[model samples]
Target: MRSRRAGRTTGPHLRPRLRRHPRPRRSRGTGTRTRTRTRPHTAVLTAVLLLLAGPAGCSGPGARPPADGSAPDAGSRSPSAATGGEDGAGHWRPKPGTPWQWQLSGRVDTSVDVPVYDIDGFENDAETVDRLHADGRKVICYINAGAWEDFRPDRDDFPRAVRGRGNGWPGERWLDIRRTAVLRPLMARRMDMCRDKGFDAVEPDLMDGYLNRTGFPLTARHQLAYNRMLAELAHERGLAVGLKNDLPQIPELVGSFDFAVNEECAEFGECAALTPFVEQDKAVFHAEYALDPDDYCAESERLRLSSLRKKLSLDAWRRPCP
Candidate 1:
């Protein structure tokens, strides 16, 4: 798992920190479903909207397991895999109050009985996505969009000129978002991989690089442009896009993104800032590392945010708001 946007420098890097001590993969077991209010009306609205928006992107053909500790080979795949997204118009739009599980570390425990699952885009293969879809779950692909990691298969594709200072994570550096001409194709490839893997949505991490001490003269305008570009990429691939922790710009970006992914908003007294998304009927998938579910479940329920208590490592364990 990656760090929170607010505590980027201090939040733990779950994978890099445990590279040598990887936890053993656990077999999929039946997950206990959290009791949530069924919103039959909302589901109907979403389905109607999807139909009006045209067909969803096609799932990638066949299940080719990704290599151990690396991304799948994009070179051997057909260019059509990256070309399904026509005009960035029709895409999945998850509504407010949707329950979800975010697991980015260790092997994904797919038994979680929620209607949604968010997992790393590179770590898991097409087979995992197929299984999730088989179980009638919407899968969100997690990608490090605002930063460059040395461990990715396409690491060398990023030029040194675009790499900035470390974002408090090991072997990870912030990318210069202003360099769109250079970064556009790279990010498109990542989104392409997500679409090709049959993901329904995407949660791009570290989107608020401008607010951090990145070694670049980034402005809020630059951040907005880059984030909007990311949303377009996902939509072009016919996948839902999320605004990850850039709360201050929610009012401006709510229309561009399909949903929002937040970290520790309740702890920071910023949960209200995400209301624009909910008010627009978009989901806000949130998590807290330090606070117990008891500390904020009431507020979470009151606000109708999809909130949960998760360990800093962000493994399978989770305590959802009741």
Candidate 2:
């Protein structure tokens, strides 16, 4: 649940994308249905995935969660196989324990000594990314991949059929990611902005909405397909991509992504969920607002996650794990 709301994970809002216009009338009557234990799949979709991302294996045998009923989600498909050859060449792959500054709100304090920065994709422009690169730092462009925010410039581009139930956050609705035929072009354009702006990596947030009450028939397979499509888009453009907070899919996706970005994994006692990224020697860039440095830093350091503590506003001020 991306949100027990009034709690973790309602991040920064996008800057207004267009002049104030009447919101397109939205259909608000979609029914929420109980999802099945297994996601439905067709041969064509599987063939498309195998063609886009080659069959890549898990980073390690131990990285797979146990075969018991306790870890049934472990059977999900991995997006890594498609990340082979030149797909991984042009992007920045952060080290397992790199220090980072995540400030999606307020004027960025570029003087922070961290080697990486995560900032809003819409609010930040090409010059902002260039400045970070000038200081010998890698930059990650943060975008809402699963939800649509009214404030975004391209807000009107979302079709009524694609919008789903509200995500507790005001002016935001989860998009039906299963509609890749429609979403790919739009998301590709957003990634094009990232590439044109000189971003080194991308953090696509709200990807786990399929696990929530998003008034859609989205299955685990749909999420896997959409996420791999995002990865391929980023890779094709020569930009690094992170699998944001879809912890349940880590074992299947760690190889497709260069890193992972998570919120409140520490607060929820779920930091261990990111072990697959670390096992593959990839970074787990984690943040917590509810816990103090004293409460989570030791465990974060032990997990080798590059952890930080910042308010939910995601401003410039921060307390990094020692």
Candidate 3:
């Protein structure tokens, strides 16, 4: 089980490709249905009013991911150094409370009414992105960052030594994040694919490796360094990046990331951990698979988060916090 997103009643963070990790229905074991990931919505999104009137500023060289065993240092390499976003070269930074649509399964549904759309980076091609943009939506590319799935096209690229135990779901394993030197280039290439496809931002899932029971000796610092380097890579490609499901490190990381994507934070009583993004006037894009929008929408509004209700399959249907 990758987590709840990985399987029903289990891990819930990874955004598997077109086909989801299958789980048995009406499980006698847990009295639960199979669960799918409500992928983190991303895009270098801005307010719709501003976006349609102007083009995004995602053009030019930005920052590079730090070398192996390094963290994003304030003095040496901060996200702002490469982005300095007020300038035209940096990518678009989403404003607080930006509206979005997240759909990761079924046929591409472009009919949803939202300014931003987060979809599978590989499953959906450049045409899908162009269609969304023509309809006036910013697109975010979703990729699983911290875990490796056997089904992915790049699965063979990862050496077996770096692959840890399966993460709740079959065919998915937690990666040894300590190997930043190896992951940085792979991740960068993926981010480059997103940029080349015309995506405005990238959402990297399963980023909370430190908190998971992966079969590796990962520390908080290891996670921080790796996550920071991800942000730098996104910025370097002129793509905004969202911090997915890694709530504990929000304070230390909010400045480095462009936005936040979380799952069931409200259900787990951890929504408060995401306020740093809100306080910074950045969008906190959140979703709940099991909770009714009524249960959390009001509080989400108060916190200035763009909260929505999604099924585990993360299809086109969504209930936004009104």
Backbone clashes in model 2, listed as residue pairs: 17-152, 17-153, 53-82, 54-81, 54-82, 56-81
lDDT of model 3, residue 243: 92
Residue 121 of model 1, lDDT score:
89
Off by over 4 Å in 2: 1-88
The sequence of per-residue lDDT tens digits that candidate 2 reaches over residues 111-164 is 777678888787778888889888777888888788877777888998988999
* Ten residues in sequence with the least summed lDDT for candidate 2: 56-65
lDDT of each residue in 53-128, candidate 1, tens digit only: 4221111122222224222322121211211122236677776777788887777887776777888888878999
Question: What TM-score does prediction 2 earn?
Answer: 0.74
List candidate 3 segments past 4 Å from native: 1-89
C-alpha RMSD for every candidate: 14.4, 12.7, 14.3
TM-score of each: 0.75, 0.74, 0.75
TM-score rank order? 3, 1, 2
The model with the greater lDDT, 1 or 3, is 1
Clashes per model (N, Cα, C within 3 A): 1, 6, 15
lDDT tens per residue, model 3, 187-275 = 98889899999999999877876665679988879999999999999999889889986655676898898889877766655566677
- Better model by lDDT, 2 or 3? 3
